[model samples]
Target: MANIQYVTKEGLDKLRAELDHLESVERPKISQQIAEARDKGDLSENAEYDAAKEAQGLLEMRISKIKDQVANSRVIDASQLDSSKVSILSSVKIKNTANGMEMKYTLVPETEADLSKGKISVNTPIAKGLLGKVVGDIAEVSLPNGMEMKFEILDIKID
Candidate 1:
């Protein structure tokens, strides 16, 4: 069974657009290459034909993978989420208990996570530790480097 992924509406649209481009633009180009190669005769020794067939296989695999992703993706409705507790799509402000440093991050789906934009993946250790927690709660997280850290949840916002 494929894992169900939570995504925003924009992400779904992006996936759809990519799929359309692969089918409409790329598929025909590969077909044309194959046809041109076939006209050269010598079916057993045509490198161009083999290359084009390989390219077509890769393109079909990508299209099928994207189709599966689109089929399993579910859009998260931000307005329907509760702001009182941390969850997917929550913007949380936290303070490091050990160093007195403060940082804010928005917990987003894996596909939408961008560190430069202060968006973290919900599957991350920090985000997982903060899940289902409310403001003023402390979260204890274990990092992949074998280090433990504690962070205080200062605020939670959903938009």
Candidate 2:
């Protein structure tokens, strides 16, 4: 069974748009290339035809994967989210115990995650450790560097 992925409405729309583009734009482009290649060729020895066929197969696979993702996606209602504890769609502010530096991150679905924008994927180690933590709670998160860092939750917000 495919896993149900949580995403915002915007994220779901983006996926649908990409899938539509792949099906309508990319699919026809590949077909045209294949037809053009076939016009210049004998069946067994045409490198262009072979390459176009291979590219079409890969494009179809990507379209199928995107369709699956769209089918299994669940849109999260931001207004209905609880702010009592850290969770998906929650913007959390924390202070690093080791350096006393404060940072903020918004937990989002993998498709919507952008580190540069202060959004972290829910599946990430730090987000997983921070989930369900409340203000004044200390969380120990294991980093990719093989070191554990301690943080104190300062606030949680839905917006």
Candidate 3:
């Protein structure tokens, strides 16, 4: 069975838009390249044709993966989620126990995790450890590099 993916409605729309672009725009561009390469004559020495074919293969693979993701993805309703504690779609403010530095992050699905936007994937170590924590709770997260970091939950909201 394929693993079910959870995403926000906005994330699902982005995936659909990407799929449409790949099929309607990129697919035709590759076809045009292939046709132009074919018009150049020699099949065996046609590097352009080979390159276009490779690109087409890669594009098709990407499209397939996105299609699968869209089909399996379930939209998570942020408004319906409880914001009293740290959870997916919750904006959490935490302070590093070691340095006293505070950082805020929103827990989102893997597809929508943009660190620059302060969104962290739910699968991340910090998020995993903070999943059910409330304000004033201490969370110890084990990072992938064999290190652990501790944080104190400062606030939680739905924003």
Candidate 4:
């Protein structure tokens, strides 16, 4: 069974647009390449034909996977989200307990995670530790370097 992914309406629209591009633009382009390669003659020894076929297979597989993801996806209503606790789509402000450094991050789905934009994937250790934590609560997270860090939740909001 495929996992049901929770996404925002914008994220779902992006996925749908990407799938549409792959099916309409990419699929037709690959078909044209295969047809051109076939026109070049020999079937068994044509490298162009082989390459095009391989590309077509990869494109189809990607399309299928995206289709499945779209089918299993559920859009999260940000307005309905509660700000009482840290959860997906929550913009949380936290302070490093040890260093006294403060940082703000929004917990988002994997597909929507962009660290440069302060969006962190909910699957990340920090987000996992922060999950279900209310404002003023402390979260202890273990890093990949085997070091433990604590963060104090300063505020929680839906962004």
Kindly list the per-residue Cα lDDT of model 1 for residues 34-77, writing each as its tens digit: 99999999979999999999999999999999999999999999
Tens digits of per-residue lDDT, candidate 2, 51-95, equal: 999999999999999999999999999988789999999999999
Q: For each candidate, what TM-score against the reference?
A: 0.91, 0.94, 0.95, 0.96
Off by over 4 Å in 3: none
Better of 3 and 4 by lDDT: 4
Stretch of 10 with least lDDT, candidate 2: 40-49
Ranking by TM-score: 4, 3, 2, 1
Candidate 2 colliding pairs: none
Of candidates 3 and 1, the better by TM-score = 3
Q: Judged by lDDT relative to the true structure, which candidate is superior, 2 or 4?
A: 4
Candidate 4 residue pairs that clash: none
- lDDT score of model 1? 0.96
Q: Tens digits of per-residue lDDT for model 4 on 72-146?
A: 999999888878999999999999999999999999999999999999999999999999999999999998899
